[model samples]
Target: MHFLPHHLADLAALAQMALAFLALCLVGRFVGGRQAQFEIDALAGWGLLAALLTLWGVATTLSLRIPAAAFLAAALVAVIWPGRRPDRAAWGELGRLVVLVLPILAIMATILPSQSDIFMNLMPNAAYLVDHGTFPTAGAPDAHSFLPVAPYNTQLVPFLGSLVIGGFQAGGLALFTICLYLMAALLFARMLVTPIDGADARPETRPGWAATGFGILLVTLLNPGFVPRVAFAGYGEAPVAITLLFAGWLACRAMVAMTAGETGRTSLVQLALVLVALVNVKQQAIGMLIAFALAAILVAGYERQIGWRRAALAFGAAALPAMALYLVWRVFVLTRFPDGELKPLPFDEWNWGNLAPIFVSMGKVVVEKITFFACVAVLFVFLERRLRHRQLDATGKALGLAAATFLLYNGFLVVTYIGHFPGVMSVEAHSFFRYNTHLALLIEFALVVTIRNRLTPWLASCPSLARQAGVAAIVLALLVPVGFAKRLRFDFDQPQPVVRQLALQLAPELKDDDRVALLLPGDTNSVDWMLMSLLHFSAPRRPGLDVKPWDHADQAAFDEAAAEGYGLAFLSCTKGNSLGLPDHASALLRHGADGWEPVKVWPYPPVDPKQRWQPALAPGPLCRS
Candidate 1:
């Protein structure tokens, strides 16, 4: 299969991921035994992969290349190990859907790196790893080298891509994200169809279950929050949310199985690994993890399925891996990145007075946004029946637990946003919808699972109409992205114009030994950081070129760099003023003594002419007298 040079990186990444998937499956089989189902095996495999990556990241941070080498060796061993395959019927059924969905996913992954977050942090972090082969430390020269308290378990895909492609490839990293999304969707579909103990698994029920599972999968795929974030933006929240969903689903399954006196050792182990991976993926996951654990305990207690002692033991077992991984990362952060503390915002003084406005704002968002309101409705619908029916079935318990987790998740967000920004409730209001997209998916899933049985009879009665409706729904779901496509400016076939212009303007003037101080704001979405990444990616062979963020407070560093014969680069918008010039650079520019003159200003495409400015590059030597 002949492939373009650019496509080779993504292809290699996909190949490596396939290898990793196989390895994970083998490891899962080794731990969970041959009796484990595909869902259990898949979750277990992902957990093992997460654990290995966690260890790998720590090792990289410590500058120990041995673990990376050991991981490759382990992957080889996993590939060689013989393992039992999934149930033939189940595999065949799901394989068809996977095949249908894979190409769309591939296309999305290819173009996904254009999402701003990739440029903001994920890409930079991955590029740093590719360039230096280690995590940023306190001693790192650039102030923005490593974000404080940012858990980089999510960056594993990008790191792995860098390893596979022999450089940083955004498309490759995005493919990894897409795989996680697909795996989550696959597991969700399998969970819906797979019967719990005492549930009717007859041929009649199979079709209904299959239809329900397809519905769930379609809804998840069509969700504005799930696929877009997973495929394009490379948000850690998507992976964390989906992993937690799978873990919660498994926990419910295990609880039901345990009640029936059937032990689910593999399920429990898989849950443990996923929870651990969740903690490592993002800090917010810690709260979600606790919520899931609590829901498990409550469900077990409510059902009186198993003894409290046994239930506690199972939950604790599932929590062990996550707890251990947390401790490991905690120690690593303390020793290596002491400044990496989990304090993004200050906790306001205890006050009921502070929460009222926040609650009002949150309520407004939930009601005003169609997507958020629909999700809220779904949660309520699931809760209405499940709460009233005290004599709950396994499905009821699962749905109930999911609802509880969703409620708890929202509560956590409320506390976080209100406590952190007491005065600016509007800020939380803006992000409230975006942040809760995954929670919405969980609610929708719970709603579908809970109501599927009731709708199955109706669906079976009108088979022809049902078939037409299903086809139409799928077609509509597929077409929905067309509306979104207009908003997306990125082209999979072409280089980003900003990147091209930055490279053209800056790369030639930048010498191997030159240190270029970026003149840009300290905002999280600063375009200068993206410029730095583009420069590094384009000129990988150029050594000893340091690109550091310039701030007014860093006057001494700027002065020292200028004194030491370094270069200065200013980023601006083609239609607007420069992002901001540092005080030292302004002084040098005014005097015209340091050869700080206007270089070529590269124009970039603007998302919105009114709000966003087109990227412009201005580079000059800072040290020339």
Candidate 2:
């Protein structure tokens, strides 16, 4: 009976994720056109997220049912419509890849919610949304109630998932979002291996292209940060990063078409939708959006395909909706919650001394994660250009745009780190590494394309045995670093049985009308908080019971709680330490050289005495009214 709720919850969440995936695929087909399988996958993921954000905004402002109905209608139309289908060969290839990837996806989905960020803010905000159907106001009384008013559009996906799956199991949302990253990676792989327009029509080049693309895909998949690690961490960076990749991919396609003197209307519209979604996901993506716009204009001017007027109009048409949405959200926040505005760090606090260390650390990360493949690709392109005595082609032009964006985005990061300046450049300096993943991926994509374009002809001329050997060598070379990095960084250990037992024992002690104060240590792990929240969720009196951290509580607050007969519990306490509690409370808990004695705590429904152990809590002055 105890295990049933967990099973039902997982099943429900899985069902909801499937429905979302189907709806997204349909929407992607409707908006982006039926292109390659990988293209369709990328488009579907992008469209789904964009639609979800727009509907969520409307739902939060108007009514939740409206968005629900709208989504159902869209999904209905997408399902009933006769969409283009991929050929047998394409399906066969996709199936093979799926077989290879599914186990990793399953493991990732199962363990994702255990990530630390869920407790810090993600799960709490999601729980608030599930209970209230909207963001909490600044006036609400609770721990971290001020979070809702902050710039956190990233929470919407998990909130939406919680609505469908029940409450605050953001692991489900993370699993669904991972689809976007997988699709984007697959799309990059497909583009590299497959022949794009303007490719040499020579039949001999096909096999070499296939081999090269496969090798690149293998290397990319093996990257530690690419798969299960960052993908399932439930970081807001996942959506923003994937969206930027999609935007870059679309922009590349558009530039390629324009270079051939044709306007790629479908690609351009898709690009616009992606950019809008990017900004909504993370405010920092505004920089990338602007950089993309500049790249679009510059490419147009250089190629003279659509001319300056049409180019400007096209770029504006793509960016305006996103800009408008951002403006509206900004206005709403400022007007509704003026006091919730974030203050910039003082410029005087900026540590210029940290610059050298910051650069060195960032450079090392880049070299470890990105530099090798990027440099090789560039060198491949250079050698090809030199040997062939040819000018830059369409792929080369797109590469230029990607390279420029990469540089511009990194430059922005440098300025940002200097300005924000988190003190002491240790692993904390690497905190921003997640933000850089997208740019690094983009650079890799551009390089892969350029290398494919230049090397396919040369590779086609080589003997079959030599080509096979070369591909094997590249894969081995890439795997060396991946072996060292060992992609699994997260703690996969399940929560201890003692924690669960303690939570169950305390549930009956809680009353519907009572408020419970949880006094957590200053250095408490997020997992501890997550377990505590789970305990509260499972309590018999959960509906009216209020469980909160009392880190801000004073002596008077404790005295009042005791007078009112409220429940209080301390987690993992020891002698001589109050864990950030006030001095008066500290003395009570450590009256003797040894710590306070534990007392028996009862389980719900009164279990046998033999099973009961001494409670972690002991009576104290603060608790004696």
Candidate 3:
């Protein structure tokens, strides 16, 4: 009967793989379009499905034979399947897409705890919600009740985790992330179509759509702060970025439809929903809101058309509830603090006056942080423009506006972050880079659209050798760096300091309600926070006792605990472990009569705490010291 559990697990894993594949298929169908979209979608669908099935087979509790068969079959199919065709131009486009997705995929794949470990943190919330018949407003307090002031409640991300956990799968975040990437890619490709209708300077070509999509991927991936975020940590920004880009496409479509004879209400409604959802994803999306609204207004003014009023209304209708939700959260939920201050910096901590300084910092950001693919986007913009006429289109203008808006937004962000960045750099630096990447995605999307009209003719006009060389260059540019970066960062591959090891070692000897303090001696503060959060396995009332340098009371509390003979002690054993504990505590685990017994220790190296997280460019590292 217990073996049946293994069989059932195998079945469940298979089903999850099938589900992921089906989702990819649907995405390809919706986003890819008629020509390469279908083929590409089908290939992606099958590849992901195969990968999923292989993973399931490998993980199943079934005898190794089942997994062996699954992996062998998948490998066989992949080998036999048509490899990427040798069309250099098409391959070049595909290369760009891969480059764009790498950072997002890397972060999504890594950054979080292991699937088994994540369940330890996420399941309690889900079970509580299911038991209560609703999602709770806060984290659990006592074993049986909610906390009065839950500091680290998993409200938003946990719900998504819960949905996946309910089904006993580890891929919800991955699937959601993948879908967002696919959605943005689709929207970007569709926008590529809209500007192709005219004999304007840029003419439609086979490479056009690919170039456009590739461009979007490049700018978004290479965004100023994106690399740190992806290479290091994920902040649920990728989906939001994808959503906003999709919203831009929808808005672009609605505008063009209005320009043409189609003023259907459905399109307007869809447009509105996208806009509203964009607003809900994050408050900083306001920059986008203003940009899109202004773009709409500008389009209206340029055309002398009054009908855009209805379109704008539809967009507002979709957006209003989200806007209101944000206000409700801000005014009531988030802002109900002492003196009405939100406490956490709202819309990030940057303002307008520090643009010059921000730009000054760009040399480091661009050189050390920016990816090669992103640089290609800027190059492509120049190349595409030179190849065609000198003028920009509506898409170009809108993109220009979006880019300018982003710069303005960053200027504001720099001002706010100025106070924080007094010494080295502020945490807000990462946030600014992350937020600005959104605008970069928008600009990249617009550039792609403008150039989409002219790509085919350029390819047709060029010698096959030239086209092949260009394509080879792009492929080399994208693939080589990806290989190097993956090796350098190893985001998904790096194992976190074993929290379970620490937990198991510490938990067994201690009586219940034992208060344990976690202090990082040489690591960044974020690491301490992460470790404390992970320490929740004990169901502690206030698990993470961060012992900062200035807290004498905290030291006194440890002194009191030592005098009282606390049951067990867990010390951060890393070299930089500075707990204000004497050197004897480090060596002997006890100070004459003051320091507690060191029953267990976990070796968490002091990671650089102040690293940036730019989801658009890269990921930040997990700082769990």
TM-scores across all candidates? 0.79, 0.73, 0.59
* RMSD of each predicted structure: 6.2, 8.3, 11.7
lDDT score of residue 158 within candidate 3: 26
lDDT of 3 by residue, 126-194 (tens): 233323323223332321222211111122222223333334232333334443444455445445444
Cα lDDT of all candidates, in order? 0.57, 0.53, 0.41
lDDT by residue for model 1 (1-625), tens: 1122256554655665554454455556556554434444555756665677667767654542345445456656644555554455545654544554554444453443554556656666665666665666677744233363366666654554445446555554565555666565555555454554332212312223334335435445545455454334566667666677677666776777787777776568777877876787766777777777777777676766686778778887788778788878778788887875554354435334656666777888767777756766666676677668774677777677777777787787776765554455424444677667656556555665666656767877998987786666456434444444433323321324544454556777666666676654332334455566666554443535676655332445446556665566443322222324332222112113754555554434333324332232222211101
Please give the lDDT score at residue 170 for candidate 3.
29
Candidate order by lDDT, highest to lowest?
Answer: 1, 2, 3
lDDT by residue for model 2 (271-342), tens: 777776677665566667777677766655555556777777777787777776667766766765566544
> Candidate 1 — which residues are off by over 4 angstroms?
1-18, 35-40, 53-95, 131-134, 140-149, 161-165, 196-224, 227-231, 344-353, 418-430, 461-500, 520-525, 538-544, 548-566, 571-594, 598-625
Q: Top model by lDDT, which number?
A: 1
